[model samples]
Target: MEKARRAMFFLLLLIADFSVAQDTAGEADEFHVGVILDLGSLVGKVARTSVLLAAQDFYTVHRNYSTKLVLHVVDSAGSDVQAASAAIELLESYKVQAIIGPQKSSEAVFISNIGNVTQVPIISFTATSPSLTYNSMPYFVRATLDDSTQVKSIAALVQACGWREVVAVYEDTDYGRGILPYLTDALQEIDVRVPYRSAIPSSATNETIMQELGVLIAMQTRVFIVHMSSIMASLIFTKAKEVGMMNKGFAWITTNGVANIIDSLNPSVIEAMEGVLGVRCHVPRSQELDNLSIRWNRMYQQDNPYESPFNKLSIVGLWGYDTIWAIAHAAEKVGISSARDKQPWPTKSSTCLESMVISTNGPELLSVIVQNKFRGLSGEFDLTDRQQLKVSVFQIINVVERGWREIGFWTVNGLLRKLKRDYSKKTGQASMLDLNPVIWPGESTEIPMGWEIPRVGKKLRVGVCSSEFTEFIKTYKDPITNATTASGLSIDIFEEAVKRLHRPLSYEYLEFDTADAPISGSYNDFVYQVYLQKYEIAVADITIRSNRSLYVDFTAPYTESGVGMIVPVKENVNTDMWLFLKPLSTEMWFGSIVCFLYTGVVVWLLEHLIGNEHVHVPFSLKQLAITIFSIFEES
Candidate 1:
């Protein structure tokens, strides 16, 4: 009887062993996620790929869960109709317990509406539309920055760059549509504004959208703040080039939506992206982000899941790893994985979000992370008093050669060059060059209420670069000293102008004997000739180009002199009227007539269009057009 019982037990054991193995293999073959996607059609593909990889790699290593995550991808594909279809599939067909995403808010609303009815919690990775959280839509949670935090962070971003104008181009979906008011309000505090804005629809093709980008090109807005996701942005850029609207001077900026696939950065795209400025909660990918990358890279490299030709791939890959770490913070502490043997996992569910930090007695497990600051590759994901993510510190990045460089270098010669009292040093070698003393937060200096040239001798030789000076010299010599004062005037007049500084003034004269000489060309030749150790102070009404300013010391010019386009008196018969008019005299009278008419027309147009401020700068299309036309005429 004992032998018979043993035989029966062995037979039952054998049957169970095969069944368990078959189930394991089946689980390994598939993983699932509940995803909702709409207007972010193209980005949905990439994001879904990333999430799928995360699920797959995590399962491959540890087999603790009863079932492996088989990402049940549901695509709204940027359509309301399709969004509803995808949502029904995930809820009914997949029976997924926890959902990962509905990428855009337009489609996300449908998921939110069904949340309480279905009792499934939705964890959104990138749905930033404003309407998502309104009216206490239960069962909704976010994994990415919302439009408010995004715009506020952007406000900090613009403040960081000291930029005043940002051009925002957005699609008319909840994702883009919901952001403008908050963006405007946030920027208003920082004194920054969306000067030129365009609203595009998510359905617009590349060609349709690129036409709008042409206007950005014409506006020449320096900072381009794009509220678009990667898909539409990639389209706008491609079309911008196709329509001949791309230029090197533009500064392109975008939200974190474009931060994911940074590896798309390559010579072809990056070269044109020199001034491309974008924002990402993702820690700007660097060699620092790579330590985590090596692990995941070994996991999925076999599949070539990434199609990004840009090195930005390496960055996003590392940041994605950071995402895993962030999840580990929650899951390993509060979800199915938190080991109770350790300390508390903070609030077991979302209710404890207020305490920002999650602590556990499983120090070894938590210690595997926790030590290196709260920074996840996406950025420092610190919590606020209100259970919100605070990443006020933003990293502004520029696309470089197959890589990315932080937008402003360790140097400020680029961003601060425009301030009058403050300036940039050309060599970037770090020497103070501001006419205004550099100030620290606690210190103050008396700005030389202004600078003055102390009175000095008019006998000094000044360096000069105008042929007009030479022309005057040829016709008449100072019968006293045979020195030719050019433009039929005394260099002493220039000297006298400097003496008004209420300080000792010195006068010097320099002559440029030719035309066609660049200020750089002339200075190099002149400096090469003079030894400045002696009475070598030189002065001229030399137009300062940054390069030339470096080699010599120049006093501020009392008058700016440039070669005026000389046209022979013709056509409207002004020559007869000008026979008695000498240069300055004629310029005086004709200038008045021209100036009055110009001012009158400008004021008239301002009143005609933008309604009332007659003396205001041109802000309307018609006024701007007239101003531009007049500038062309004047030029």
Candidate 2:
């Protein structure tokens, strides 16, 4: 009886051991993913909800996978330090396979650096700065389109409308500055000039924004390309309208940062943005996206009951959703045993210090993630070799009274399509004319010329050379009035060119040298006055020579070219007694009389030989002589 009891106890112990082993294996299949976000911001809220929903949906459809995603959420509190702390915690404590969020580019830089050392994949959906390039951070994956990608489209729009110059207005941040170089290059490629860049501090006050706008308003550029956060954009437009910059002839263009979130703006903000044009990422519509949008809206409304109805989900949210699913798909492909390996913590003396935990599975997981491609809510979810989401289409939206309206779409090939009907049938080159009619600033349909004379500023100071030689450039002063006037071929050409401008240009001509004397310096010195900012332009017989052009811009040459010597010649004497006889030398005068007699005799002989009735009547010697005399007289 004792042996039987011992065997039964051993059998029950074996069964319990097997059950514990199965439970351990099941736990190992669950992969941990960390989410670091600025939950205090509206974008963060939407992203957070989208990620959660994505994880739920991914697991439901992918139940057969050997690995499951277990998300760990942390709030960065909109602080870079907090984001770093959260990343460290998620990396060291939870040992997550991958991390997402820290929406801003500045925040992403900090976390991505940590991710590089830790060998964990850091995915960002909203950090669109070009500075966050994958070459710098191999483990970093940008699930959103880089800001630089949209610069070409913006440049195409500017070119199509024939805007000569553009002024970029951006926030003074990494996100804002990163796109400037690309935007400048793209604009230059299409023969557009970026005259000035207005950078507003992220924390700038309303007064500061207005001051910047005032400076822009006082300049010649009327076309403004705004590349900043939506909040800053709203303030800029608001202050612009307050200062009357929203009037006719002014143009405003925005990138996706502000354009994609137009629906979330307040009515007052929309009103301020009236007549503004913008570019937004284009996501193809599908049944799955439609259902997802409806679900996201309901969930957002439930999350924030005090806020107005959530009508649309931003591209960032869609990216968030897609990022979660991508992580899950990648994790599943990597398998449980390989993904759940415990990473090694760095030694005290290691280069990475306390932040040194190396993930054994990170490289493999990243490789899988980079290769993962699928159709998601935002559109096709293909990633470039750098792991950036491939975006080839963008919509140009115009701000109207009813809100933003789609005017056209910009493709990667640099074509603009007006509507779905046009896009489906589009062939050949795209043009600005293909876009829906735009209501320009001041509620006019006339296309803006993209420049205007400053309404409030000093008149342009034109430098004129006071010449001792009055033929080329002359300056005169009225003795009693002391009013200076300048007139010359150069001045006439300058005035004609100015008159050809679509608007009046206010200018005041200031003599570079005193009117009492000729210019003291060479022509180059006069032209250099423009470069020295002493004058806005120098108008004279300013020769467009190679040396002069090195210092200042020159208009097309208006005067005849080439050089000729003007030396004095001795006057001829016409009143001399022998002047008439001087026409012939003594031998030449005698020779000329003999030759005339010979010619008259030859003519009379030819008339007698070849002529008919007239010659017959003149056959008499006296008549022939008379005819010869008449012929000589006629000659």
lDDT of 2 by residue, 1-635 (tens): 99999999999999999999977765537788899988777678778879988888887787667788889999998788999989888877777888998789999899988888888899999899988877888888888898988997898888878888999999999999999999999888877899899999999999898889889999999999999987788788888999999999899999999898888777888898899999999877788888998888888888767775734688888999999988888887887676555656657574535645678888888988989988788887876575565577889999999498888888854556543444433322247777788888899898798888897989889888866567777987678986668997778878998999899999988876553444444566878878999999888776577877788777666666877889988788478787889868999999988987888777767776886456676257777677667666778
Over the stretch 1-635, how does candidate 1's per-residue lDDT look in tens digits?
A: 99999999999999999999887665532223465644234455445446656655665666664434545666676676687667656654554444556666766677766553444455565677765663465556555557666665566545654556777788767788788888899888867767767988877976668667655655535456677766677776666656544443344567766754555533465444444555655345466456545544444444344543222233334333344434434343333333222222244576522222222322332233223336555666432221126544444455544456553321233222223334444321122131112221112221121122322223445554443354222223466885644442335555566667544544445454444566457656655444553335544344556665666656665554665887786568555765775656767999877976787577566556865553265467876666656555654
User: For each candidate, how many residue pairs have backbone atoms clashing (under 3 Å)?
Assistant: 34, 0
Residue 537 displacement (Å), model 1: 42
- TM per candidate comes to 0.50, 0.76
Error of 2 at 336 (Å): 3.7
Question: Candidate 2, after superposition: displacement of residue 368 in Å?
Answer: 1.9
Question: lDDT value for candidate 2?
Answer: 0.83
| Global Cα lDDT for candidate 1 | 0.52
Candidate with best lDDT: 2
TM-score of 2: 0.76
